[model samples]
Target chain A: MSINKLAYYPGCPSDGTAVDQDMSTKAVFEKLGVELVEVEDWNCCGAAEVEDPKVVYALNARNLAIAEKEDLDIVTPCSICYYNLERSNKALKADEALCTKLKGIDSSLDYGGKIKTKHVLDVFVNDIGMDEISSKLEKKVNVKVAPYYGCYIGRPPETAFDDPDNPVLMDKLIELIGGEIVPNFNYMKTVCCGGPLMMTRGDIAFDMARKILDVAKNAGADCISLACPLCGMMLDGKQADIEKALGITIGMPVVYITQLLGLALGIEPNKLGLNKNAVDTKEILGKVV
Target chain B: MPIKTWELDPNFKNEIMGEAGGERLASCFQCSTCTLGCPITEIVPSYNPRKIIQMSLLGMRKEVLSNPDLWVCLICQTCTARCPQDVRIADVLSAIRRIAEREEEAGNLKIDSPRPLFDKAFQHQLEKYGRLYDIGLAKEYYPKKEGSFIKGMKAMMKDYKDFGMRMFKKGKMGPKAMLAPKVKGRAVIKKIFKEMGEE
Candidate 1:
């Protein structure tokens, strides 16, 4: 049977600073005739902190239960959120002691271990397949884009769903939408996106963002795109800060991976979440289309 | 060396981590794997990952509460992948970071962390206008007389012409996109900082 509906989890960033990310993802998915069933009553997955022994797994545990109620696996676009939830779910399944601990916190929420989680990159690469995605390309984006695969998705390969060392979810999505991938700009593929910087330590967050942009710009990439909103928020939402801090013109069109596909599928920009970005993607796309 | 007794910032140890990572209680050991394998550390050695978890574990509340190092970890899995004890080294670092951000915002934590010349010059563009306008981030971050400013402007001008700025002016770069729904918590953010001693 053709898979028509996808259970989606838009992490905290999607609800806030990274809203455009979800919109763009859906806009393209909508055109592809794939419905996104957003996980109901979902809570924060506690990102990196859920793994601590003293910390109850209940926080990250809540999300998997929500996905299970619907009897469907979840698809997340944010790599950090995806990694956290996937990590928690994987751990819960492997360790009965962890499950016993979680049950003690919320006896009502049993760890039946029925949920499977994947980043949006996984759904795009595995479920949708490049052939179907390419068939929907109404327009071609000629920009030389460097695909930015942040750490959460690629480093472990468990969450990668694609090639870990040099994942091409970003590039495959671009090609599916008729964009040219710049083959050479690949050094910092598994690097951080500074999603951790928005809070008290923004200098380092912006520092990481500037480094990625430095490489992208030098490689002559017209744009940099990704699936993680936090990463996108760092690179796409914080472009000006990077320039102000570093005194470099690293103003490539930092966009969500799906936004590129949405454009090719004839989805409008407003629905794809481009309005809130720090970089002027409208300016760059203006050159391509 | 005997381990130091960590006196966690009550707000941070109890409220921040509890709210953030649910009080990640002293679970990390300093293997230097996070620092050793961290890609950011390779690029910038000052970006330490192991020291961060140690500070959080020791509950050196003030130090971790005001740390600029807190926000630098990319959540890149370098530390998460290497921890032999199953300590979520990266996430714990980030949870502490989120708490520090609140501290900085509330004005309780007065810290000075230098950004690179480029990021210092233009990060405000994203925070304010929500899009990167090269012309704008540059003006806001740098003074025109600075040699770096002149050099950056020249680069944009050169690239613009090379990429067909004249045609670009006609509006045809790529797909048009939109922003997503704003997360519901304008006051919560303010309150978190205020609770931490921000005005």
Candidate 2:
């Protein structure tokens, strides 16, 4: 397999709440022959809490500016980071004054918008191509996996890499891995997981996540596969809390898309950080072999 | 019964239009597609993205700006993606948030939720660490730095007593959360924040 490369921007949550995502992404990408070089001196995408648009642009621009020097398109596993960085890259490319203003923030940094920002799914589906990935799969995952795109990356026309209404990239990847797509999951595919509503309004966030879990459960999904860390944290990390709050049992294990792919590639469940998941992934893994 | 007057500040629309991604508000036609598409409205009845846009356009500045629901928008962009008129409902809500923040800072407006304070603490974390250090941000978030420090401190402790222990056991927070490492280019991050008037 020929080595492919990407400037990986493993967004904030990957450092802690979603370390399993970080580990699985690297392991799976490496297994697929894609080398993810951490964008040198990269910082946060500032998440959504930062309300100022200019500051959002500047924070993401700094990351892009660093990666442009590397001469490789930036890729992030986290959707919100992908959205924020891509949004900044587009904004700077269209407005010289904005780039100049961002540059003024740091005299040493340059913001020419020279590189592209890609979500990991884009690199997997479009760049690497499913045909290449399919050829490497050791075994097919036979269980039904619900593909959740969440709400961040696949939105706001210019920055969206796929259809905002019905994203099929994950579905394609799941198919490539020989995993059965949850047919009834089409309705809940792009719904908001209530990430931002978590701490501020726990009830609303929990209820929103509960609704998604209910949809997936009703679809008879064996597990849920997602890209964004926040969504993973919401569905996986908060599953118990949500269950307790809503007085409903949502036993579905939420796994990273990379982890699912890694599993299909015959990577050990432990190596894919399966144990790091809050909801037990053992049941789903038990069905695999 | 006497009719109640709506104190409409005509500048609200233009003020929101001044911000980035806010220019799309002109195209909104009250088609209610945004409302229909929003997942938040399904759960939280008070958070109507369409109504908020209508109110903002109507220049109901005081009503729109001070409402706690103003801070409730998830910025998920579902409404933005579905808006038939190309109205970026999420971005418009963000613009309203910015205006609300400025007003609150000036003491010209009052908000009922602690979200803004948490957002500010988050900003401070970004300014200091160039990334979100969850434990660091949480520490800054709960404790009252303003009026009624003792009461705020008690509330923060109560919260830690309530949810903090469980979060730590779940591996979401604790020594690991506190171990949120700083980004490599700390100086550059500080410079960007300072230059952007974030400091």
Residue lDDT tens for model 2, B22-101: 87777788988988888888877887878888777888888888888887788888888888888888888888888888
Distance from true position, residue A64, model 2, in Å? 0.9
Best by DockQ: 2
Instruction: Give the DockQ (2 decimals) of all models.
Output: 0.11, 0.58
Q: For candidate 1 chain A, which ten residues in a row score worst on lDDT?
A: A48-57
- Estimate the overall C-alpha local distance difference test score of candidate 1: 0.62
Q: Can you write out model 1's per-residue Cα lDDT over A1-289, one digit (the tens) per residue?
A: 1567767887755644566787788787788888889876555554542223223244456667767878788888888777777767777788787677556555434556887887777787678888887777777677778888888776554454655557777777777666777766676776776765443355666777777888887877888888787677678656755676677667677888888777777677777766656567876566446
Candidate 2 lDDT over residue span A134-163, tens digit each: 888997787799999988657977788888
State which docking tier applies to candidate 1.
incorrect
TM-score, cand. 2: 0.94
* CA displacement after TM-score superposition, residue B51 of candidate 2 (Å): 2.0
Model 1 Cα lDDT, one tens digit per residue, B1-199: 6545633443444554564343443556676766887867865677776776665555568877666655455557666665665566655664565455556658787545422233423333322332233455445434432346677566445433423242233222222212322223323222222232221
